[model samples]
Target: MKTRKAKEQIVKELKEKFEKASLVILTNFDGMTVAESNKLRRSLKEVGAEYKVVKNTLMRYAYPGTPVEQIKDAFTGPTGIVFAFDDIVAAAKALKEFFEEKDSKLKFKAAVVEGKVADVEMIKQLASLPGREELLGQLAFTLKYPVNAVAWSLDNLFQKLVTVLENVKAEKESA
Candidate 1:
């Protein structure tokens, strides 16, 4: 049995986490082996997320008076939460990939992002998004395309002018 002070500390930590996390995913980790769970933790760590098992009661205590209260009921049955404070999409994508590759029984129950409770379909969509670096690179390329096009157009115009001058010189010589 946990002492009152210990429970309070845990609740305090959980409440702080709930307030700060950008994304919170609840999952049912019923049949996953310890090794598989560890692997999932490592994968989440790679993307700067954390995975931990929490008691339903404790979760309720932590979430009371917070935006996370909406997901308090989903804390039932072998609940493990992945909290992403850095990159929400990366955390979801990494967890989804790990679950897919391992074929483990870890099932996503619900997710909350930016204080809004997200359904399963929304969670899947979030998971489908490319990682942070990839998205940044894509945005950068998109922003750079117009600049590149203008540069190419200028180069083509200069080439045309040179070509016209060369043709004029050729005509004079031929004449």
Candidate 2:
């Protein structure tokens, strides 16, 4: 049993984390073994995320007056939340892969992503989104495509004009 001071400190920390996190994914890790839990924690860490098992009461106390209060009911059961600070999509994808690989041992609950309350299906959609770098790369490619096409067209036009000029020069020389 934790002392009152310790619990207060924990609640304070949880509140701070909730405020800092861009994505907060709630899961029911009721049947997870220690090894599985550690593995999941490590996986989340690799993507700049951390997982915590919090008491519903503590979560409620910490999340009051915050955007997370919207999903206060989700804190029931054995709640394990992943706080994603760096890349929300990467963390969600990681959790989704873990969920699939574990055969649904880690049950999906609800999530607060970018201050939006996401249901189970919405969480799945969030997980399916491409990672930050992938999305940025795709955007870069998309932005570059028109520029590349224009450059290619200009080169083609220049070549055509050069060919026409050469044909005229040759014709003039022969004449």
Candidate 3:
């Protein structure tokens, strides 16, 4: 049994973590082996995320005044939380892929992101999204494409004009 002071310290730490995290995923890792759990942790770490197993009671206490409180009921049953300080989609994708590959009995319960409680399917959809850097790169490329195309077209048009003028000069000289 935990002492009251220890429980209070845990709740305080959990609250701080909940506040910093962009996304909090609740999962049940009932049947996952130790190796499998370690593998999942490693995968999460690669993307600057961490996973923790917390008591449901402590979680409920920690989330009472935050957006996470919206999904308080989801804190039940062998709960593990995967969270990231920066990229939500990266963490989600990592966890989703890990679950898919391991085929473990663990299941995603719910998630809280951007002040909303996301459903299971929404969590999966979020996971499918590309990471922050990839999305930014795609956006930058998309934004630059039109300018590049216009430049190319203008160069082609200038070349064609030059060609036509040379032909005219040649014809006059020949005439």
| Structural similarity to truth (TM-score) of each candidate | 0.87, 0.88, 0.87
| lDDT per residue as tens, model 3, 1-175 | 9899999999999999988888988899999999989989999999999999989988888997887888888877899998788988999888878777737777888888887888877878988888899999999999999999999999999999999999999999999
Error of 2 at 147 (Å): 2.3
Q: Give the better candidate number (1 or 2) by TM-score.
A: 2
C-alpha lDDT (0 to 100) for residue 48 of candidate 1: 96
lDDT tens digits, residue span 1-175, model 2? 9999999999999999988899988899988899999999999999989999988888888998777888888888899989998898888888888988935579888888889988767767887888889999999999999999999999999999999999999999999
**Please, what are the lDDT tens digits per residue for candidate 1 over residues 17-55?**
999998998999999999999999999998899998978
Candidate lDDT (C-alpha), each: 0.89, 0.89, 0.88
* Stretches of candidate 3 exceeding 4 Å from the true structure: 1-7
Name model 2 segments beyond 4 Å from true: 102-104
Ranking by TM-score: 2, 1, 3
Which candidate do you rate higher for lDDT, 1 or 3? 1
Clashes per model (N, Cα, C within 3 A): 0, 0, 0
